[model samples]
Target: MALLEVKNLGISFGGLRAVNNFNIQIQEGELYGLIGPNGAGKTTLFNLLTGVYKPGEGSIFLDGKNITSYKTIDVNKAGIARTFQNIRLFKQLSVLDNVKVGLHNQYHYSTLEGIFRLPRYFQIEKQMNEKAMELLKVFNLDGYSHYKASNLPYGQQRKLEIARALATNPKLLLLDEPAAGMNPNETAELMETIQFVQKEFHMTILLIEHDMKLVAGICEKLTVLNFGEVLISGKTSDVLNDPKVITAYLGE
Candidate 1:
């Protein structure tokens, strides 16, 4: 069975359909790509899957359970997590603290217990810190764990956002334009990092990226969208060479 399934999914604002009749099935450990020109509804689709927006039609199933209307927090608890097109981090917080915030859901102690310095709270906090550090190490950001998130360079900030997302222990990770601001060298390194994270975490990834070379290089499957509808989907080579995809990119 697929790890995640989107069946005839769609969303709209008043009369404008932002996404239409979208369907995709991602098996466990698969690395998939979602691509399109600007305004192709890729981000909109990400929002729908992550529960940032509710679908107007169709259903979403994760691990065989319908979650078409699950709340955002519930979705995170269900093992789905994501990073935004623009980096989102707590600027003033240390990188370590930013990651720990994502670990909140995994920590079971109550706020009162933390305030009172209860034994259970202390234990959970220690565990959370250890886990956060481990993730930073995996991304090679352990050396900067004490730096504020806003102090990191653009690429490092992006990595930190990803590290923070991984802290949620998601089974399916939705990455929106992870390499958006990266230079060629940084993008190259990020590609490897993404693959490493997927293998290390044993998770499925669905990424929305505009860089065709990067998408073609790493993603095993590709889905192309245009004006909020799927133009084509298949092996990367086939989809990129398709006439419709060419037209979509050129016409824009």
Candidate 2:
């Protein structure tokens, strides 16, 4: 069964349909790309999947279970996590703390236990810290665990966001324009890091990226959107070479 399935999904703001009849099916451990021009509704679709906005039409299924209108926290609990186009780290918090906060949903200790510092609370805290550190190590950010999130270079901050999302133990990870600001070297490293995280965590990834080279390099399948609808969906080489995709990128 597919890990995630979006069937004829759509959403609109007033009379303006931002996403129209969008659909995708992602199997476990698959790495896929969603590409589109600005205002093509890529982020709006992400919002629908992540529960930031309710879909005006269609349904979403995860692990064969319907989750079309679930709450945001409910969606997270159902094994979906995402990073935004804009970095959303807690700037003042230590990198480790920022990741630890992501574990809050998974942590089982009660509020009373936390306030009282019960033995179970301490035990859970220890486990969370260890897991957070392990994630940092995987992303090669262990040395910066104690650093303030805002103080890290822009690239490291992006890595931290991925690490934090991993803390949710998701089955599917949605990365929105993870390479927005970086030199070629940094973007190259991020490509490898993304692949590594998918393999190491055994997670499916659906990424939205503008960099054709980056998308073509990493994504096994590509979906192109324009003006809120799919232009093409196929192998990276095929979709990238499509006349419609070319026209969308470079108008006549």
- State the lDDT at 245 in candidate 1: 93
lDDT of 2 at 25: 84
**Candidate-wise lDDT, in order:** 0.93, 0.93
Taking the candidates one at a time, how many backbone clashes does each contain?
Answer: 0, 0
Error in Å for residue 55 of model 1: 0.9
Task: Write model 2 residue lDDT over 1-252, tens digit each, in one string.
Answer: 988888999887989989999888888899999999999999998999989899999999999999999999999999899999999999999999999999988888999999999999999999999989998999899999999999999999999999999998898999999999988999999999999988888879999999888999999998999999999998889998889999999996
Worst 10 residues of 1 by lDDT: 243-252
What TM-scores do the predictions have? 0.97, 0.97
lDDT of 1 by residue, 1-252 (tens): 999999999999999999999999999999999999999899999999989999999999999999899999999989899999988899999999999999988788888998999999889989988999999999999999999999999999999989998999899999999999889999999999999988988879999998887999999999999889989989989999998899899973
- Clashes in model 1: which pairs? none
**What's model 1's lDDT at 252?**
38
